[model samples]
Every structure is written in C-alpha cells, then in structure tokens.
Target: MKKEIVDPNYKGEVIKHDVAKYVPETEYVVKVLERHVEKAKHNLKGAPIVVAGGYGMGSKENFDLLFELAKELHAEVGASRAAVDAGFVDHDRQIGQTGVTVRPKVYIAFGISGQIQHLAGMQDSGIIISVNSDPEAPINAIADYVINGTVEEVLPKMIKYYKANNK
Candidate 1:
C-alpha cells in the first residue's frame, strides 16, 4: 500500500495572521497592570477591583477614566469582553467567562449593565458595588451596594472616600 502525502497548502489548513490589529496600541494598559502588581506585592494596595461590563463607557477615552480611578485607589483594574471589544480596555485585563475570573474583595461595576456571563466571573466577590445611571440595571441586583449615578461623578467621590477612610 502506498502512503498518501498531505499538501502543505491544503484548504483545510488554518493560518494565523502575522499581526493582530485587534490588540490595543495604548502603553498605559501595561503600565497600569505592572504598577498594580507591584503595589500588591508591597502590600500598598486596596481591595481587588473588577470593573464590570462597559455600558456607559462608550469609548477608549471613557475607559481611561476607570484607569485614573484605579490608580487613585491603588487597585487592580478589570473589565468585561464588551469593554475590551470596544477598545475601552486591553484584553489582558478582562474578567468574565471568556476572560480572567477574579474574586476581588471589592468589585466595582461602573457603567456596567451587567450581563450574566460577565457576572458569573465576579459574583462571588466579597463586596459588590455598582454605579449606574439606571437603578434597574441588572448589575445592581447582585451588588451589595448600589450607587445610582454616573461613573464620572461617583468615581471621584468614591476614590476620595476610600482613601480617607482606609488610611
């Protein structure tokens, strides 16, 4: 019996692109992740912070606000696939069924409408806090504390409060 040889150019063969355009160009993601890890190692950190699905965080610029808040709080930043897909965050910091599963001490949901898939990853967190303009947002249902307001407004106040009280 003769052995058959497979063609290298077979149509069924899968090929990956040389570069991925889907990845973000921002260097801040790396800086933020590294800084948070360093802070955690030094015990100069706050509770783990997972920012849920991106609903009101409409653009990458909006997501930067979350980074600012995280920096102020000295907390780790996490996000949902929607936020990554929308370029609000890098894929590396995603937290959901398709991403990293985090059980942060305080999971902050900012502008996240809370899809079930996203909630499955962080629902077991020690404390769940959500800030949304709509009180009826699904994320509010699972949150231990709900702040019905805009992230832009609430995050500053929150950062201030946590720093003052925790310190």
Candidate 2:
C-alpha cells in the first residue's frame, strides 16, 4: 500500500487515486436536545471599587459603617460568607470561592481575615486595602495597604479624609 499527501490550495495540479479499495464511506446522524437555562441576577462584576465586610465587623450595626463609606466612594458593597451567614448582608454580596468573583480597580476589605477562599476571588485586583485590628491577619499579607484598626474607628476617618480631599 502507498500514501500521497496533497496541498489543499494547489489549483495548478490534479492527482487521482483509488481509495475505495482501503476505505468505505460512513454516515453519522446528530440529534438535537433541548434544555432549560436559568439566568443569574445582576452582580458586581464590573464595579470600579468594592468594599467588603467580614465577621470582624462586630455586628450588623457596625457593618452599616462600611455602607456609608461605600456610598461616599460610589462603590459597590460586598461581604464575606461569615457576614452573609450572620445576616449582615444578602448572599448575592458574598465574595469568595463560593461567591461571585471580582476584579476591581480597588478592593477595600474591612474586618476580613482573608481566607484562601476569599482571596481566590479578589487577589487579582489592582489594589487591595485591608482594615483589621489584628496585625497578623492573613489578609494583611496580600494587602497593598494595611490599616491596623477596627472598621468603626478606621472607616469613619477614611470617609472623612475622602470627603475633605475630594471637595
């Protein structure tokens, strides 16, 4: 038996061979099936800035401070699973391995311990700012800037500074 290769774009030459002696034609039928698709609701996929709160926020009332800062910055609000489980925010706002991923220009984490699961989602952000009382928190390791203070103490000062400077 012998084999020959042909160029698909060679219009100047023609070659013929008998392939019926070694091969046979086969036909295939494809079946189309229908399935149901559910659309996901709106999320913070493209927000330029995001503020995420964690359990260290202390309570729902303390979490409200983050919202005030987010409002001032014109940023979207997010939360860790711990905050969502604690009913501080809705599940849609959760950010982690089990939540929506985000790549914002700036990610400000308040009271978050920076678990691996949470880091997986936002580690690619252009800048990461962490605020926590513990200096040894895991989130501090990846933070571009770390503020060692409680959210209530630090966030108010940050908001005041932003307001003072932006004006």
Candidate 3:
C-alpha cells in the first residue's frame, strides 16, 4: 500500500508493483430468470399478428400506414433492418436475425421484399401475407397469400374493412 498526495482523506488502495505480465480474460454466463414483455399494442414478440414494413415503403410518411393497419388488426408493428436504418421506424420494431424474432399467427408484410435475415425471424408464422408491387419479391415464396399492390393502395382498404366489420 502506498499513500498518494492527491487526496486529503486518502484511503489505502492495494497496489501491485512487481507483477508478471499476463493476459486477462473474461467468461460470462447468462441465465434466464424470467422473460417478460410489456403487453401493448406494439408488443411484437407476443402479438398474434404482426404488420411489418420495409425500406420498400419509400418514406417515413408512407411507412406510417402500417401502424393504422396494425391497429385495425390488433397487431404489432415491425420493420425490416433497411426500414429501421432508413429512419422509417425504430430499432426496437425491427424484426430479423439481427433483431427480435416473432412467430405470430399471422404476419402481414407490407413492402418488405423478405431479405433472408428478415425471413429468419418471421418464417415460423402460422400464415404470412405479403403486400408488394413486385410480383417476384422473395417474400412471396414464403407467404401464404400475396397481394400484388403497394401498401398505400392496400392498407386503407384493409383498415376501412376491419373498422366497418367490427361495428
């Protein structure tokens, strides 16, 4: 132990003076105690339906239609990595191998072309419905139904139909 001139109230600290040069390593183990996700409209992992969009949505203003459709379907909102990176949505809402995985009963993808990373997260969904203008979009391969239209053209109709039918 050595005293330092820096502090008036100096607490003795252990000092290693003559020590062999050695590399230090760290090993960590994480145990799951309890898994908890807040129950909310946008809770992706637990929602029975997920309404997801992608960079193909074009802009943040255009991307917002997914939220309206999600609300009508009582679904959560998710986004592709490209959508999150492009500032169309938040990272928490991202779904893929790099983000949260969801196996919802219904996954309605809007504008997403289904990058392989994204497919990993949502492929287990009970039913996948893709809405894209691209008839050859990779997402179409996995989807149970494919709507050959843009989200702008399809989402309003979906929301309107759901709203009217709910009444």
Candidate of highest TM-score: 3
**Residue runs of model 2 more than 4 Å from their true location after superposition:** 1-43
Runs off by more than 4 Å, candidate 1: 1-47, 51-53, 160-167
Name the lDDT value of residue 64 in candidate 3: 72
* RMSD of each predicted structure: 13.2, 10.5, 14.3
Q: After aligning candidate 3 to the native by TM-score, how far in Å is the CA of 114 from where it should be?
A: 0.9
Q: Which ten residues in a row have the lowest lDDT in candidate 3?
A: 19-28
Tens digits of lDDT, candidate 3, 78-141: 9999999999988999999999999999999999999899999999999999999999999999
lDDT of 2 by residue, 23-104 (tens): 6554224445887777755447788999999999878887787778888888888999999999998899999899989999
Clashing pairs in 1: none
What is the descending TM-score order?
A: 3, 2, 1
Tally clashing residue pairs in candidate 2. 0
Span of ten consecutive residues with least summed lDDT in model 2 = 23-32
